[model samples]
Target: MGSLAPDSMVRRVYRCMCGINPGLEAPTASAKTGAFAASGVSREQLVIFLADTLRGTAEERAPLIMAMSQCGTEAAAAVTCEQVAEFLRDLISTVIQIVVHRGRLQGWQPERMGDGSLGVKLLAEQMCSELKPSDQGFCDVSSLEDFIFRVSQISLYLEMLVAEGLNVSLSGRPTPTLLPPCRETPWKELRCLLDLPTIMFLAPQLPDRYSAPWRLVFSTQLHGESFTRMVAGLSKRGPTLLLLKDTKGHVFGGFASHAWEVKPQFQGDSRCFLFSVLPRLRVYTATGYNQHFMYLNQNQQTMPNGLGMGGQHSYFGLWLDNDFGRGHSRARPKCTTYGSPQLSGDEDFTLDSMEVWAVGKPPEPEEGEEGEGKRSILDVDPEVQAMMEMAGKTLHSQGLREPEEEQEQ
Candidate 1:
């Protein structure tokens, strides 16, 4: 999509491919595209010619080109006929629907975008002759551009997926549950604008341990108490991401490198950082900031009944109240305050929304760390575990797990 820079397209595609098959090798175009050979054009020539048309300083295009090259290399190494077909089928279907939905370009009317999207309008007209866009007699130029761009880049990605594979179809490969889409909001759209260098710098800073797929597990507004419970239950298992939206529409959050604790002392490593979403994505590290109170805690004295963060007092970071909408705010200068944008104590004191995400899988066991025993579901406090067991039996007696656990049994 034109909304996405060239580098973003390459990264998303590459990331998706890697998620689909982490071990996939890089790829190059195969000789089987006989049409090119028949036309006396080799892949190298086509690429060089395309490169000539790309307008930018060498430095500007280098990373994007490098990403594209990497995608091709991976595609060439482990592509299969089935994988290519599946990828293409899904891409075409998705691109078409996405284009038809957005249907806007540079705020221009359909009659003005020229012949690029004429086919799109004609098809829409067939479905509903009175539709606003169809009535305008103009196709959406913006959506069309997105369509073409996505198609071209994704096609290249698909080709990479099946670069040198034999044509064959097997029926038994288990399909994975698609990763849930990231939260869609104004803040997220801003995050997409980060450039390659910034992204590279932030990559390792992410609390997530995995490089490829990350899924959304909780949104305060959507999940309510379940959200708090899930965090309290699982935060210690891995890193967690917190995103908060203030009353003024400012979006920012922190990463907790260690499991959250309700204790009064600051916790977590330097890997913990704070970042802002709107205006632009800028990350602030804990290197020189106050480190004593950049921690997550939960207790009654906490301004709100739920979860809150700060150095010692509830002066910095976000505070998500238990009742959902009432007690939330991001204020003052703490670990991320020195050079970062300061939130107004008055305007941002009450937040609009809050979200939390569990980052990456639990860390793998490292050398000599195997002796440390992790707290498991059964290891919860004796009284709590006993209560849970009683509740489990009660639910079972009521047949709550009848059909649900039957399949597993």
Candidate 2:
């Protein structure tokens, strides 16, 4: 009989790979060799097999890392794309044999690099890929491209989830929640600083709670509305995230447990915090003392609307006054109310770009939880707590509900 077609071979390998469980280690060499042999694909054919199978690198990092670990190869050292593909094929077929035929998960390990740094490897819970069905007979060029794009989107979204520390170990194995970033846009620099993985680790979603996957809800530049007007659509959504770029090239924003409302009073609980994304990814959760300190008031007619960036007083103000060209606000930047590394506001910088996203779910109070609200930081620095004391007292003492909206004269 004729040898199996290249696509057939790839399907076989993919089937084997899918069979491997995330919790197991890589199979032995002899077993791997035998699987490929059974598939009728020689060593020379591995590259062609891989080229015909996988595509896209930006979101393929997790799968590639796992494959390399199983094959006892490392990608830490500079390697060509072809070499990486070859490595994946070798591991896939071997894994298929061990997991499918033998009915066992691959026991994968991180590679030890030349400098002794442990190479990147996916945790048992993080190995989620939604590639084309392995059993599917054949794929056309357009179909393959479409497949790669979908996979890339899934990978990007997963990375964002992981950044929020949603990966929890269950049954002695880390299990990540089911889900679903790369693209060119104005927020690139901000996102780079606010790395998705870091966000996952720092601000994880609460357990058993419903949180809608984050989606870009508003863009001041694209929407061409004042911040107050933009928030109209966003306020109705669940939790909210605000990302801003000042004219000075500074990128920062805030995460609020409360909606972006134009109430004439400060109306958020302790779930509001600020962050700076350009210099680095750091989150400033509520100081707790300022339980009701967030507000959105339309500033004086010419001055722009006022946003309480959350602090003791109204320190961290992100005003969106006039619409400056090129995705920026004409309002001056101000210092953050309570961010770790204070976010300084500059009057010189117009709003560069402002993006608002509706996060998964609105935070709910739990019995004996660290605090209230999902965005509430369980751990607070002693210094920060002490500093915020006076500010907290001020908020309580002064009836600082909302900034006075200019009366319609």
Candidate 3:
């Protein structure tokens, strides 16, 4: 070629760099990576390019974060892990100063401070590949120091930002709207941005909806007595069904076969009750993160129906009075027969005893409800009961039998 045109030269270089025929469409990143490695664009060059692109501008950074958080592709993770680390290290320092100086010094509530701090913490964790115990310790030290120093520098600039509500509040205020009334912030919007899936997986009962549920059953071994105790404890709280299988190992494998009707009480005050059972529970309420349930009893008093109803306070009080010996008691009978007596000493009883606890003596057994009556699985419409019995038997035959073999028999 005597003198290649500018366009021809560019095309040739692109084709050579990507190992694609000039006439063919562009190769994918995988193909390009393989080709470039052969032609001498080292892995380091690709990483550097990715890092530069991630740091380009707000327009650029938003797309990169969205891609890294949402896309389930290996390439996205590889690119994100490499780039987010450096970005996070820088972001952490800035966040620390903002939270410590602007929030603490200005008399912001701990919840508000925590919200800002958690955002920084989450960002830092996301940037790192694995957050181990050691990394957590390091983060604690760094974050504490950052908080303290920032608190010392509460200035006019910080006050303006607070007035404008451009910070995250611990009480689950959305980002960029720190101290605004809860109703004004975009709590649901930020949750959507976080891109946490609607489900999660853990052997016991799935990972409480934060981690996506893995459909496969996981086996955990338990001692016969311990397993029985666990089942009994769970049954007292709700209807529990379990399976114990011999996996041929030293450990006797166990799985939850079926749980009877533990419905999520999404209405009224019951939402808080459901969240109390999990290690970590995050709900996207209309205002922001529903932090009310996290430390309800510790930080604030329990609202009438056991919810932090915020401002919608109801005056009427209802108490469950269980007194078998005393005449004319107002207590409602505990629904289940299992361990109703044991609940009298539960911790939650102290704050909202009216809902779940008995105020006085146990309820007297009515004439018809005297014996150890068993609710027949048969009583549940024939189709449903048959299906459940079939499932229970199938599980039992598969080596996962209930401790009391009579149920299966």
Q: Candidate 3 overall Cα lDDT vs. reference? A: 0.25
Q: Which ten residues in a row have the lowest lDDT in candidate 1?
A: 160-169
Question: Model 3, which residues run further than 4 Å from truth?
Answer: 1-59, 62-93, 102-105, 109-177, 180-278, 284-409
RMSD of 1: 17.4
lDDT of 3 by residue, 1-409 (tens): 1021223222222332343223332122234323343465344433432332322333322333322222223322123333334434333434344444545222223332124434444434432524222342333223322332333221222222222232223244333322211112223222111111111111113222212222111112221223223323333221111211111111011112122111212122212212110112222112322322111111123332221211122210111111201111011232111101111222112211111111111224557673243344444256865786677744233244233324444
**The candidate that achieves the highest TM-score relative to the unseen native structure:** 1
Candidate 3, position 214, lDDT: 20
Measured against the true structure, the TM-scores of the candidates, in listed sequence, are 0.41, 0.39, 0.21
How many clashes in each structure? 14, 31, 13
lDDT of 1 by residue, 10-64 (tens): 3434433222211222212232222222345344443432332232233322223
Q: Give per-residue CA lDDT, model 2, range 50-79, as digits (tens).
A: 322232343334333333323423212232
Worst lDDT window (10 residues) for model 3? 192-201
